[model samples]
Target: MSKSQQHDHSPLHIFLIFLRMGLTSFGGPIAHLAYFRAEFVDGRKWLSERSYADLMALCQFLPGPASSQVGIALGLSRGGYAGALAAWAGFTLPSALVLILFARGLSSLGESVSAGALQGLKVVAVAVVAQAVWSMARTLCPDAPRITLMLLTTAGALLLPGMWTQIGLIAIAGVIGARLLTPVQAINHAPLNVPITRRTGVLWLMLFFTLLVGLPILTHLLPWTTLALVDAFYRAGSLVFGGGHVVLPLLQAEVVPTGWVDNQVFVAGYGAAQAMPGPLFTFAAFLGASLQGHPSGFIGGLICLLAIFAPAFLLVFGALPFWSAVQGNRRMQAALSGINACVAGLLLAALYQPVWTSAIFGLKDVALALLAFTALMYWKLSPWLVVVASAFIGWLVL
Candidate 1:
């Protein structure tokens, strides 16, 4: 049966399905991807495995929340624009609301919350990123040349820390990949038959680029506080590659040095974010709510949330019309090969700097991280359970 013939085409059905996933989905992006594959592909048969994998690859190459973009793409194929909105709202709102409320309550707590627990959460992040790096490296850079590219990318990222450096490396890797990486034999996939048209795709891509260029200038000229906030968050979202975890470094560069939110609060929110179900981009909500500027409340949270996600939506819509055609192209395959390898390397760099450096201080920290990693890798425990356990252990020992 075609996607059009599937039952439960209502936007509400889409919303409810995603909402359940949002509430229960744990681990990080990788885990979320697993849950999504099981639910949509294996259980519901909403998409064939080949089509799902193709969509996943497309979203992976785009600069935004990868899993979230996949979810949006799935919704669009299922129920069109309204379905996409419903899917996003359901998957995102749970975590966003929690973080917003947490920020509000955190302000009242002052210094009373357990620092050890927070540190534990950061340690959990270390384990989580480590797991992601291992998983992605195995899948994305299995070949010797790809492995070499991954190492080079990691070294360059560590040596030169900036958004431009990240972008430059990805671009260079793509060029090299086009020259070097062998293309995979393309597998034919069932067409999703989404409603996006070439014209709409062009418009979405144009708007994406326009906002990328125009938002900064508008903020600079107008100097409106809200505009600036949107600009900052939007840029953070626009430039993020790999996955949501990478947004950490980009966002830190944007907000932390500027003192928009204190380092302690930022770390706390990030640690808490690991425990949340949906996209790690929802961390923007916490930052907005915790901000000391004009948009520092519910409205601020909403604005920042919307701004950060807008780029992903635009890019997905823009690319959807052409994705199937490009998926089978050798040139596009080579580019993806390079880009995916670099993404693994980028995740490695991220794992070391902010995640490992900040979280691991002593033997105790190492032990806790190892324990969490074991739970995730060996025991095959739920990430949420590992997170809660790690926090408890941290509070007790750290």
Candidate 2:
């Protein structure tokens, strides 16, 4: 087949590729994107370069986490619904398990250094997110109208930091974009060609979600430690947006506020998560470990882990067969438009106040961030390196 005509969108293959991504992908979103390009574009030739770029743009245009969304998009291109689940599981599992492991080690550490490390980690998170905005803007926000929406959303988010408010703006932006920009004809529209008949489609979707919902319940009912693990992961997986960092507060809300974990321990685990290379949801691991003294012990850890990751899995699977349908639907598209615009706003708001102000603690942090940005944008060093260097620099200066 011609390079443009290379059309192997196999579900099993996608699962395997993402399994590799789960195992190896790290360095946050930029690093994850680079890994994705390596796997899908250079290694497999699954998508033409232009098509891959277009797909990346589309993912950025949506809500939720960009890397996760991109991974799902890739799987959808490969094997329709099944491919999406495989991709999510593959990319998420390694990091999730790693975080859990890290959590076990964290409980014994003192609170002070852990808190400092976490604060630094937040800087890394903010910087990386800003990097995403810059990269996406260069491509996704190119047009006059889109740029307008991007800036506008940023302004709105600055004034209002609430998640839903930010989400609303993206939906509006999508509407304006659809009206203004031409429909981006995807190069590989293979997954959109799902042959799921109506009855089969409904049946499959129902069964898929049922399994997703039932698995956690069944796991919960079990007296095994696995039940708690499953529960924790499921909750975290199900709701986190903008990747694992966003779940910081969610974990706090679910566990801390409920007295599942205390403040000192919570802060310490959050810090260690920053020191790690995997996803932020790894905080769940820390939470699980700390729960050792609780009634559930291992079960609690297991539950936290499972609850944390379940949402993402559920969303990915539920939307698998509906990828094309969601992409094409007017109302869903409208809501997504607002959500995307809100995400942009959220990023912008994040860029200014907490992300920038908190990190730019006087001249030193600013210097580090500028240096980091330069290394990323101009020197083109790997993002993980930037993060590590930034942490060391921060530690040294501190």
Candidate 3:
């Protein structure tokens, strides 16, 4: 490993770096991943491209906000427990704070302002995710079989349209890739300098499962609204796959149907979240603060925020050690290849349905999307720059 890889990053430094990203990583989860790649992989050389891709595959396999999980994992690799916490705080706090304020002031903000900016944000999402699908496809699905797998996964996700289908598709793709795809060999084969030991990882894994199994029962016995919030958000976090966008329906089902939040308010918050520069899971914070009774405000936001993200942190720590253990296993590597390809497909599917369908209503929207894409791909402007331009241009035009 180079000295750069071995150098210890201060927790404060990690927090600051991620805070900058949190403030500027606009679009959505897919776009956030692209920004992470640019900052961590390309700019900082914090990890190899292959390792970054492998870590993303792991995040995709497990449930939670994929981009947020990736940020947490990166922090862990860089600065241990404090780094992970700092990363989550820095990347999440900005959006959570904004959304909570939005929740508190929903009556004043109104729909018109949010609607136009949201349209702009959605257009930016289309461009950012398009770039991601293209880049990831080249990296993860270069071969015919992998390309076929990508296409099939995209089709399945579009045709079926649910979290379960997305999970099953990824699982099936893993199985198929293990059997059929070329075994992936690590490029540099460097062990990630993750801070936790195998024993600690095992303990974390046990705690994760314990909570997964016990939280619901605890909620049932307690019968408190806060506990209910915990149970609802925890279940949504544990089950969602693909990325932040997919979390929408799951969260909507959990909170909206329960009368915890109005459907219109839930939807408006979702739109605003797309425009913000952080993890989509932070929407939980908005919902929590927006709740009709008890624990509303900062306290409620804190509860929902932690509940929703706990599983992702647990799974990352638990899985990292085992990931190191399985590095040499050809079948495991092959499965990851398949999983990565399918992840590309998932992004592609998301681009079409919610992103493309919602954002592209006419030639004007189409023109804006193309302009944003050009700014990113050809002009090679910073994504934040592109996002800002798209938002302002959209505000004026739309």
Candidate 4:
């Protein structure tokens, strides 16, 4: 897979392609997958059909943003570590830059326009998140235990919005998965050792965790502004489970409370993020561009990018090394199973609280939400088109 010697693509061309994907790739993980399949698997022939599918599966199995991970992997295939970085840049740069520009515009817009836009944006968020819940439920909730877990996860998230609470749920599921989902070989082996790659990934996890905990504490005493922000995003990117919407909850915890971005503004940025293409992680671009102290904008976007994706890259490079050997392990499978079930719950929970409750404020709103959902589910419309129609409808309804 080495690209150092002979390759059809130069590093720059590969980088540019990813950048375009970042700039224009929208729709949630599934949509992102379709886009990737079209461009890389069908159009570019950058990845063979089988290889592309394998990469998508690997990303789906891991935590963090799956689509971003896929694009990064595609980048790595092109030129190793450098290629990966290039891909990250390509995928994120457009959104980051565009968001920054948007933030600047928002800063200047009169209150009347801003207020109306913000209100409309929140409604859009509600609709978008609702769609996520319904789509994921079908894909992830095939069994009863999983369906129950999804329900529980949603309830727990609503009842307790604490950071540790979220992490605790994910951890608890991991244990259940280990027991219930252990593979046949792992069962036969009796006890399996952690692969060196997983160990490397764990080390990165711990190292990053240390920075996350320590940097903020250190910054109060010293002058390490960037480190704290970097650590925040690095941690956010690394630890988050479901992509896009999941990160929204985490980012809300880290930033909004601190007055980083006002609640409505964040919602608006999210509304705007959906309008673009690429991974939903580009919402990080908006946070970076708009945050006070200006860190949330350009500089903040960089931190968010690294924070959100760094762990993913490490895990991909690290664990994927051992994934081939461990794929059939029931325990590994179980863990993913449990995690995925919870993931379904997480989305469902999200769908109810912020999405359904807040978005469906009135009868008209509910009708619109249902209409949009039906279009997506049955008519199989493009998300972008739905979003555009929804935005106008939101404006009209308001």
- Comparison by TM-score, 1 against 2, better one: 1
User: How do all models score by TM-score?
Assistant: 0.69, 0.66, 0.86, 0.58
Off by over 4 Å in 3: 1-8, 110-116, 184-186, 189-192, 216-228, 242-275
Residue-level lDDT for 148 in candidate 4:
79
* Ranked candidates (lDDT, high to low): 3, 1, 4, 2
**Candidate scoring better on lDDT of 2 and 4:** 4
Superposition TM-score, candidate 1 onto the true structure: 0.69
Candidate 1 — which residues are off by over 4 angstroms? 1-71, 74-83, 99-106, 109-112, 185-195, 206-300
Global CA lDDT of candidate 1, please?
0.80
- For 1-398, candidate 2 gives per-residue lDDT tens digits of 56433335556666676776665443455446655664566457676543454454444543346677678767755676677767776776665555556555634543445444444554555556566556545544445655677788878877776556644565566666556555434345333334445555566547646755777778757755555445545655554545666767766776666566788878877766654544556567568767635544445555665566545444444444555566566555443443444344455566776557766666656666677778766786655566666666666664
In model 2, the worst 10-residue window by lDDT is 184-193
What is the RMSD of candidate 4? 7.7
Worst 10-residue lDDT window, candidate 1: 183-192
Tens digit of per-residue lDDT, candidate 3, span 117-166: 66787788788888777877877787898899899999999999987887
TM-score: the better of candidates 1 and 3 = 3
Tally clashing residue pairs in candidate 3. Answer: 0
Error of 2 at 341 (Å): 6.7
Q: Ten consecutive residues with minimal summed lDDT in candidate 3?
A: 106-115
Q: Is candidate 2 or candidate 3 better by TM-score?
A: 3
Off by over 4 Å in 4: 1-87, 102-106, 109-132, 177-312, 319-325
Answer with 1 or 2, whichever has the higher lDDT: 1
